[model samples]
Target: MARTLLIAGTASHVGKSTVAAGLCRHLADRGVAVAPFKAQNMSNNARAVPRATEPTEAGEIGVSQYVQARAARTEATTDMNPVLLKPRGDGESQLIIDGEAVENVGAGEYYEAGWERAREAARKAYSRLAAEYDVIIAEGAGSIAEINLADRDLANVETARFADADVFLLVDIERGGAFASLYGTLELMPEDLRDRVVGAAITKFRGDPSLLESGIVEIEERTGVPILGVLPYDDPGLPQEDSVSLPAAGETALYGDSSEVRIAVPRLSRISNFTDLEPLAREPGVGVAYGPPETVLEGADAVVLPGTKNTVDDLLELRTSGFGERLRTFSGPIVGLCGGYQMLGERITNAAVEGTGDEATVEGFGLLPVETHFSREKRVERVEREIRGVGPLAGALGRVTGYEIHMGETALTGPADRPFRDEGAATEQVFGTYLHGLFENRVAREAFLDRVFEYAGRMRPESHAEPSPYERAGALVADHLALDALGVSHENMSERV
Candidate 1:
């Protein structure tokens, strides 16, 4: 029996994904061979996985499951994500199956056909992983309580049904209605599915589990389901899913107490492509934190000026917050990616498109004399280029593929002033370029982090532990499943759901 676990949320931000990832991490540490799953996830954050047998649409994979794969130490994103949806503006989304896009369809019509297709895709994907790992921990879509919608083609309950998922987990905590949310979600799920639910968990609990002990009892009494556990919030080993979603590195540090070394990243309104600091957080003596612009990056190692969707607006805010000037004089290694890269330059074009039907340009910080233009043809493909001379990053980018969903084309003012011939990995202090997942390249992480530590006046610790992200993600899934009231173990990974 291949055991399958489902983590359904009480509400959107009730810590479903975060909780699930943590569980996966713990399980992997326990030597449980685990795989992470999510039936359907809706987000623009996607990744490239080439190992899947059945070809889906290229550029249609969500990076959410990829996060779980990393935690579990899995390498193939295709093996983890078989179906993905990238939403386009007006009521329609791009359908990506098995890692490739077949076509774009209206949301309603897609739902009319996406479930069975998604189930088949996920099941097949899971089957491949199941052969390799012992257990698969899955995540559910929006509130299972969302009745009318789930019936159509939502992957949550449908996954439980089709995947033969053995255990169901209700993640309820953040929103005050956790108790009701859990009970209600359980009650609304199909009876057979409900019976299969292993247990309910109170995740992301803040104060104390004792505070909710009584409520837990009442919950068990009402649903006839056991309260598996109340997991206290641990601040370590957690990575930010996407830049828009603020990342809390578990505030985890491997060999240090970073109470002394502090780093500040702006809480930008529309921040994008912020996976930059994953490498630093894994450094032995480093600590990463997010804060407002008021905090002087003083006594801090460096400041990261991440990317923004609307550069003009975010740049204006950066100037207003005085971070713009601060960056110029920060005297440390200041770096930016994509939109952030544009801001560090002379000016950014496309300001006119802010609201008016006109195209416009906005002056950048003028640090790098590069100009960018917005074009109709957006580059959304995997890119590979060699870094010339910026920092210690001078090497051939070996399949250093990353997605480029940007509308900007950059041109350096002169030959000597190119921002990025490749992607900015080799740039010294004040480097900016349009590349995502820059550190995903082992060479990039080493090159960038080495320069970064030197700029911070610290010796890069030799004992640095570069995390095998997919492995950590998988272990977390397994831990959650074991703690799950369902008592799922590696031996049961073959169980239907």
Candidate 2:
């Protein structure tokens, strides 16, 4: 068994992932064999690392592992995103273990069948990663302070004690309820496990970090635990893996120069498996921006409709948000994967699944000659196969390998005359499929970029694809943290007898 330190947050988005990654990288900088783990993650921004060989398990994936890989200073995406869940609408999640789809299970539906089974899944993954490392830093999900959800939640307070992990609690001071968050957390903490915690932390501080002294005093006086390092908020430059249902309406990089190729992604509700665009965002001339549904798509060479957790709800939301109108009117090349593919269809029959908080067969925009339905059987695992010509996906129809993790299945409504070499044409303006991470491959990437480049009326550089910026950024953080010694390394673990 490896020495494990489990981190939990007072609430969501308090930078738990950031702290875990930082510590792993910080410790690994000293040559320590350290890894990161998250037993259950609800984020839809799944990254398919070709390196993970384990069978994809249901409702399991590790985005934090990517953070640890960076900390360990390695270029292994698979070592991080080993288990993934690309959610399909109707409370059913597309369970993927080790980059492969297994089946779909609804929220609180399959767990009743077994808890030992889920624990075993985590144990197996932990064991596999433990074999290659010395210390494993684990992260827990959501607020651990919720008394009602303690036992049922797999990644809650009980899990920390069950795993026999050293606990580190984090509170987001920026949320304006720091005192309440800290007090409530300690009050709700299980008595037997209170002693297990080594320290509590403050995250996302914008103003004077020194102001944390008073907050620390209050928490210590109330909870009787010491404060750990007050991590000053800094941009680690890595994209967040989020499970947000509402579309994020903010632009990061939609503008600079039209001469530079820009990829606009509609900030659709319930977007899942969003990590697909991380590779594109890292490209130099390529820019990835997010914003409100309508405005986000205004200026761009190519627009991407990413995967989603709830496709119907998101489409309904897109319609309400005025984005659906813009999408139909937009002339630029549009590409969609998984849930996004469902949106570009003639109809999405909700007879099997209800995503928009309703249980009715909703109407879909008659774009692509296709329709979709939520299925009990999920396609979760990875497939390194060819994507043939269909719809707007003609010239680029070639062999490209990626994973398929979605709950809904889509088929063309009718056969077309325009002989799509790989298949029949759904239409000319829209292209979609069950595949994720289509642009990671060189040939497919170049073809996609060529379309964007032409749309932008500019020529792309000769060398199009390159290494991800996260690798470079991770390496930089690793080097910087190495200066301050924390005593964690492969050699530090045992004498080389």
Candidate 3:
């Protein structure tokens, strides 16, 4: 039986996911058999994990839980995230339970009829994981103090109650009003739930700790909960769980010289698998920025259209926002992944399957001579592809491994260049593929970036010397956390032996 600990937040994007991931890594390093859980996650950014019954069977879970499981040195399973809601357009979400998509439902309908089933799914998954791991670090969503939604908040209050988990309330100081927010959250929470909180940790603090000493003391004095360690604003550079964590618009990259190759990603309203850009952002002399929908594609060396939860709707949004118009005229190295790939085609058939109501066909960007048709069946699996083509990114000739999660099948109409030979098209500088984590493969990224820099008349910098993002996350957590207070004791391996 695993002992559970809850990481709850004062508000959304207050570092709950990062804290849980850090704790998972820290505990695993201590030889503790750890796992991560989130009863319900509302994010389009997801990762496919294996099923417990059939290891070969694949299913989707929140990306944060998947990464945390990796940090814990365990194979990711759907039990880690029992219920997932990928928001589609028109106030509806594709509800996934026990790692499979059941149906798409509106917000009101989901609460009225679907909440109980989701709850049961979480319970069963938690029970299975509890029996396996020695410790489970559960993550809570949004503000735990959302009074109106408390009864239906599956991730926070309900999880703590069912798991008998001790809570660590996290407040983001960089957002300002950390003390007030923490105090208000604690005050608003129900008494039974409030009693479960062990302490409050202030996150994203930029200044010295001593400056907050008096404030922390006052907060502790006002509330029964003590102040835990204050974590600095150092980003461990872990994969963010949601698009809400994106850097401010137009502030995506710190622009510098012509030597830097800037990649512009027009921010999609329903962007999914955003972590696909993380590897590119980490590349030496490369800057990845999220261009607003209306912004003109001017200075970027290359442009990437990212994956989306609702392909038709997001594509329509791009057109209405005028980005599609600018994109048609812009001549640059452009790449589209998954849903974005579908949008680059000439037309999309069976659009009603994606909740477009009666609309059967929608116009695409027409960059590639391809057509896509939506279907009830979804493709979600890990894949390794060989890059072959005579197009722009053909230099990226290697075995590229990634995953595909989409509801549409794109067929190239004319005899054109295929980047992955079978999966994607590469017409001149425009590339489209279904692979989500395409840049993670260094060989492919190197080949692709070499062409991009050559096209931009710039020199690609040498390989980055910084540690991998995951390594930095592990070190950051180990340094900032108070493990003793969290009931984790570092034990010598020899002693265990």
Candidate 4:
């Protein structure tokens, strides 16, 4: 059986995922067969993993777990994330058990009835992985000391207990209450669970480590917890687990030059698979700013509607927030992916697929001459399709590769020209497709950006696509953490694995 180490945060987005991923890489480098486990994950950013039922194809898992598995040099599986709750809207989410979407459930009903079944599923998955690997690194969700929800918090307390994991609690110094938060969390933790915590680490610190030494010493003396390490504020280019990690709009200028092409993405309430924006954000001379609906679309070269968990609800949100009206009036290059693609259609039928409701048909943005109908079956597959651009995007044509995870089928309502042959539809400057990672393919990405640059009266800058974000993240984790005290030997670390 494999030993376990659980990374629990003082609160959400305090770098638990980063630490866990780093540990997975560090341990793998030691020639240990390691794997990552999360009892539950609530995120829209997900990746396809190998399915146990179908060994040849891929199934869905939280993106963090998928990336962690890659860092560990192991094939990702649904067992890594047993319960995935993708928030739809209005206190409801789609429940996924072991890579399969089970049903759309409300929070009240889920806690009252569904949690036990989901928890049991997680236990079984963790047990299987424990038997197969040498080490299992588990990640916790939110604050581990939320006494109100502790009994039901699968990621923190239940995971630690089930896996017998040595716990490492992480606090974010950037949040300005590190000492108090850590103390309060430790004090609130159930006595037995508190004993499981062997150490604590401060993350996102910005300054000299020696300055924190005095405070760290005092906190350590008070709580009897050793400070493992103080990680610097370095954006190691890992995919953020949630929207909370997103910076406020205009926090960083999208471009240094006023003439550079700037693209605006509406920060939808239920945005999913946001990694689609990462590739575009990495391009030189292009700035990607996530703005709220009404304001984000103003003064931009182009607008992109990202994937959403609940198309109908988020679309409704757009209407309520006046973005739909703005989208209709805005005369600029527009792109929609996945749920966004569904929203640009004339209408959405079978709304009950999103939840238990009588709202069967919801009107879309009517930007494209297509209609969508939701179905019980979800289309989840990796695709490599050749695409040719149309209208103002005529120059943007190439072989695009991406994965699709969506419900509903989109069909043309009229005799309109299709984009990318039969895979997508477009009209003038407006385009829609079910493909995420639309900008990751260099050929397609450069072409689309070139069109935007042309429209904005600026030459498209050279592509500076760097190394894989996962490799950079692993290296950062291995460099930042003091592995020796954490029972990982650094001697010949790169050579051992």
Which candidate comes out best when scored by lDDT? 3
lDDT of 3 by residue, 160-274 (tens): 9889888989999988899999999999997888999988899988877899999989999999788868888988777878877665554454322335788888877788998
For model 3, state the Cα shift of residue 411 in Å. Answer: 1.2
Query: Candidate 4 lDDT, tens digit per residue, 270-388?
Result: 88888887777777777887877768877888888899887887888788888888889877788899998888889999887773457889888999999998887888777788878
Q: State the lDDT of candidate 2 residue by residue for 1-497, as single tens digits.
A: 66667878889888777767776666665677777777666666765454444334322255556545666676443434434555565677766554455567786765675444565666566667667766777787788777877776556564575557777788877788877887788778777556677777776667776776787787788778777556555656565677442344554444223348777777765676677776666555777766778687767667888877777778888888877777778887777778887887777775446464655576666667777877655555556665554434456666776666666667678754232233223456667767776777666666666677777788676555443444433443344332222223345454320
Candidate 4, residue 35: how far the Cα is off, in Å: 2.1
Which candidate leads in TM-score? 3
TM-score of each: 0.74, 0.73, 0.94, 0.90
Give the CA lDDT, 0 to 100, for residue 308 in model 1.
57
Candidate 3 residue pairs in backbone clash:
none
- Cα shift from native, residue 410, model 2 (Å): 4.3
Q: Please report, in order, the local distance difference test score of every candidate based on alpha carbons.
A: 0.63, 0.64, 0.84, 0.82
Descending-TM-score candidate ranking: 3, 4, 1, 2
Positional deviation of 84 in candidate 3, in angstroms? 0.5
